[model samples]
Target chain A: MDLHAMDRYIKSLIKEAGHKIRNSFLSDISIESKSDANDLVTNIDKEIEQFFISRINRDFPGHRIFGEEGFGDRIEDQNGVIWLLDPIDGTMNFVHQKRNFAISLGIYEDGVGKLGYIYDVVNDDLYHGVQGGGAYYNDERLRPLGITTIEESILAMNATWAVPNRHFDHNGTLKLIQDVRGIRSYGSAALELAYLASGRIDAYISMRLSPWDIAGGMVIAREVGAIATNFRGEPGNLLEQDTFLVANPSIHSRILKDYIRQK
Target chain B: MDLHAMDRYIKSLIKEAGHKIRNSFLSDISIESKSDANDLVTNIDKEIEQFFISRINRDFPGHRIFGEEGFGDRIEDQNGVIWLLDPIDGTMNFVHQKRNFAISLGIYEDGVGKLGYIYDVVNDDLYHGVQGGGAYYNDERLRPLGITTIEESILAMNATWAVPNRHFDHNGTLKLIQDVRGIRSYGSAALELAYLASGRIDAYISMRLSPWDIAGGMVIAREVGAIATNFRGEPGNLLEQDTFLVANPSIHSRILKDYIRQK
Candidate 1:
């Protein structure tokens, strides 16, 4: 596959999707609950997902699509070329704040990530990476993440994860919160990972996230020397929901070993 | 005192200060630690404070200034007309993220908040309120905060406050975190308050915040029918640092009564 041509096509497609999202803000948005009240889905989300699916199918007839909105194929395996898409990553923020949400998309070939793109729609920042080509934030090239100690790092994660939950020991997460210089929660996993690539933040932790939520981010973060893994220090699952930790390479293992204790 | 005229003048001064802050992003900034390593102050912060001080001293000679950088008068009481200023709220974010920081300024007359301003420099969003008039985000008027339940609200606070600390029982905070739909930490008290006033967020809590950090936000929040008080249920102290809770009036008392236990 000509990855260069595909990269250019995806960038333009994401930008077009972002434009539609911006226009949605001026119109009435219909919202619905997904798994629960907190798990929301809006008309805009489904619309944007369908928009991408239609375009991708027309432009690249051979590429298989896996999407959060279920508008794409149901794949039993990560074979051939697959496009992972999260049309709107932070639906809660979209419904309430009308900001802090993004379009996260990633492309993989036989389970190997080749290109990633996360467009911060509100901020108009597009973060993309092409495997060995490195990452770029908008027009500027992002620098490789340098060494950072936990004591001097800013960690981003949902505050819910630090409270008592079924996923892990809350005490361990609480202790990690105190050990870091500061904590931030932007309500979007994709944006948090994009921020890590650009050095705006050092690490991100999530108790539960889907493949589409981290696919684009993982590709961009890897180019900046960041690491992505489950709590068990294994590669992130691209076909299932799981706990995730993406951080600067300097402190990823330390956080995983000392602070992540599964219940 | 003609508050109308003062409000107009202050608006222009804040915009000018915001312009200066935007310029500082292009120049080299010297950073230093205050109180602790995480507590940071930058050359741009001091410069911005001095710039506001000089202008205020020249324009309104009778008004006393209470600022974060200690460049203004030593305020002994909330008497006469006073200008409370935090030239750069969220100095750490200013140094690290170059965004999410704001210029917060509040004017009070005989202990009564009269006018408030919070300028999000990078985004060019100016939030202000005139006592008895109304609050505004830029040109649009902000509506009074409608009722919201704890289960359906978004709470903004420093995540550290939910960890074991000297200020209060961490358990109460943890319970509150679980009850809320979401929690956000933008690292700027002024911006958080501005967000609350605009209904972007429903509640805000801080274990320790000074007058300058909240002076402007209180004025704006009050106009939108939000309540601001210390953990003990008294008015927020203007003369010293104290625990603070500012929330939509509907859930303010509930959170204070059930979820804020002083250790």
Candidate 2:
């Protein structure tokens, strides 16, 4: 398979989908909650997912697509030539703020990530990576991650993790919050990972996230030498929702061992 | 005093300052530490503060200026006409991320805020307000804030507040984090208040902020019917650094009374 041609084709398709999503902001947004009030799904989210599925099926008939919004084909495993898509990551931000949202896509061949793309719709920033070819933030090749300790690092962890909850032990998470230089939460897992890859922030932690939410980011982040793993310091499960910790390699092990207590 | 004229003048000055700051990113940044390694001050910050002080002094004589970089006039009191300037509110973000920073300025006459402006440099979003006249994001007038309960609101509080700290009691802050719908930390107090005024977020709480950081945001936020006060529920002091909480009126008192315990 021609990896260069596939990468070029995927980038164009993501941009096209992003433009359509941007145009939708001009009109009224039909919003509905899913699972909970905070979990929002808009009409545009479904439409964008459908758009990607149609394009992929028409252009590459042999590939399988797994997407959020339930508009694409369903698969139990990360099989050959699988396309994982999140039409709108940070849907709540999109529904309310009209910014800070992105279109995330990851293309894996034989269960190995070959290419990834995350497009910040409002900022027009496109962060992409071709495995072993290095990551690029809109044509500027991102440098590999540098070593940084937790005390000097700025982390992106949601504050909810610091409070007692069913997901994990809150005591360890609270201690981690005090140990880091600072904290940030953009409400988008994909964008947080993009930031980690770019070295804008040193680490990111989330208790629960699905494959579509992190697939694209995982690919881009790995190219820049950032580490991604579940709470147990094991490899991330690509086919299911799980706790995640992605960070600069130097501090990743320390955090997992000292500040993470599984509930 | 002609607030209308001053508002117009300050708007143009902020836009000019913002444009200059955006240009500075094209050149190399000379950075230095202030109180600690994390507290960064850049050459551009001093230059921009000097630029504002010069313009204000030249255009509006007899006015005093209090700025973050010490290039402005020495201000001891909130007496007489005064301009509180933070050339770059989030200097760390300015030197590191090149975004999420703002040009914050508030003009007060004899201790009363007459006009305020917070310009988001990268996004080109200018949040300004004329006391009694109204608040605005660019030319659009902002509507008065509606009521929101703590459970349904999104609060922008830094995660540091939730950990055991010297400033405030962590247990209460941790509970607040759990009760709220979500929390966000943008790393810029000026932009956080701007977001609160725009209704993008519901509340903002900062344990330690200087007069320059909160002055512009206080004026803009108050115009949109949000309450601005110290953590103790008293009005924010314009002469010194203090803890601050700005929010939609409904939840402001509840958060202040129940959650914030100054240690």
DockQ of each: 0.78, 0.73
- Candidate 1's TM-score on the B chain: 0.99
**Interface RMSD, per-candidate values to 1 decimal:** 0.9, 1.2
Instruction: Output the worst ten-in-a-row residue range by lDDT, candidate 2 chain B.
Output: B159-168
Model 2 chain A weakest lDDT span, ten residues long = A70-79
The digit string of per-residue lDDT tens for model 1 on A1-263 reads 88889888888989999999999988999989998878989999999999999998998898999999998999889899999999999888888798999999999999999999999998899999999999999968899998889998999988887778776898998899999988999899999999899998899999899999999999999998999999999999889999899999999999999999997
**Where is model 1 more than 4 Å wrong at Cα?**
none
Cα-based lDDT for every prediction: 0.92, 0.89
Q: Which candidate number maximizes TM-score?
A: 1
TM-score of chain A of each: 0.98, 0.98
Error of 2 at A150 (Å): 2.0
